[model samples]
Target: MELRRITYENVDAVTSMSVRDEQQNFVAPNVASLAEAYVCVDNGYAVKAFALYEGDEPVGFVMLGLGYMGWSAPPCAEGSYCIVRFMIDQRYQGRGLGKKGMEACLEYLREKPLGSADKVWLSYEPENTAARELYHKLGFIENGEMCGEETAAVRDL
Candidate 1:
């Protein structure tokens, strides 16, 4: 699995990708996530949005925001980068792409030159067992924090 920048050429493909109906409440769609990335950028947070590709086919989306520099959104922990949005398309689920995609995102974030931070954070609905299990397998631990109704988890980078 590889991550490619979301560009005009692939924006539609990325935005059209959808998670399963059961996961709708747990994740924002790629279009909304891309919009959030723009809002975060306009608010001064460094941001990155990517299309997850398996070989040459787009299969998922990920958006990352660095720091709490946004004017309206709550800030991340000091200088941490947050995985603001992520989801693999329903068509691409159950093939281990989510794990590989997350690994790719984590690897990219680790080398990112935003503010220095020891951890990366993300939040998910508490009832989203799939997400909780996937994230746990990826080494993310719940920090007993809440982002609105979502449970927050962090991983040392």
Candidate 2:
């Protein structure tokens, strides 16, 4: 599995990806995330949005915020990176790609691709047990913080 930048050539495929109906509320759509990426860039913040691929097939998407401090919820401490958005296409569910994709994201973040950071953060809907479990298994711990209505978690980089 590999994470590729969402270029014009793959933007269509990435934006068309969707999660299962039941999970629709858990993540923002790729297009919206792309829009946010644009806004972040315009506002001088760093962000990375990528399409998760397996042998050239787009199966998921991830967006990362680097050293960003614009959250309405208590912002992450300085020098923190956040997983702003993530999703596996409905067709790719149950294939173990979600874990691989997340690992890929973490790997990319560990490189400090956009900037320096000591931790990676993410949030999920309070009821999204699958996400909570996966994140915990991957070493993220909830710090009793909230990002909007979601529960926030963080892991050392």
Candidate 3:
């Protein structure tokens, strides 16, 4: 799988991607994420939104925040990167693409695409055991922090 920047040609496909019905409450929709990306850019913050692809098919979405320190409940230190939003479409959920996509995100962040950072942070609803498991397998340990109601976790770059 590969991460591709959202462009005019793929914007519709990206925005239309959806997670499973049961997971609707765990993540914001792609359109909302894109809107946040736009607002972040407008407000002078670094954000990268991408469409995850398997061959030519769009399978997931991820948005990254770089050096953002404006969280009302700061779960990460300044200069850290955050996986602000992530979701694999319902159609792609059981295909192991989530791990591949996350690996891609971490690879991208390790390059410091927006700026230098030594860690990557993410949060998930406490009840989302699937997410917590996946994140833990990917090396994210809960730091006993919260970003709003979500449990915060971090991993070294």
- In terms of TM-score, which candidate is strongest? 3
lDDT of 3 by residue, 50-135 (tens): 99998999999999987663546464756789999999999989789999999999988989998888998999999998889999
lDDT (tens digit, per residue) of candidate 1 on 109-136:
8887566777899989999998899999
Best by lDDT: 3
Which residue pairs in candidate 1 have backbone atoms (N, alpha carbon, C) closer than 3 angstroms, thus clashing? none
Per-residue lDDT, model 3, residue 157, is 93
lDDT of 2: 0.86
Q: Which stretches of candidate 3 lie over 4 Å from their true place?
A: 75-77
After superposition, candidate 2 runs with Cα above 4 Å error: none
Q: Is candidate 1 or candidate 3 better by TM-score?
A: 3
Model 1 residue runs over 4 Å out of place are 69-76
List the global CA lDDT of all models.
Answer: 0.84, 0.86, 0.89
On residues 34-58, what C-alpha lDDT tens digit does candidate 2 reach at each position? 9988888888888878899988899
Better of 1 and 2 by TM-score: 2
Instruction: Compute each candidate's TM-score over C-alphas.
Output: 0.93, 0.95, 0.96
Worst 10 residues of 2 by lDDT: 68-77
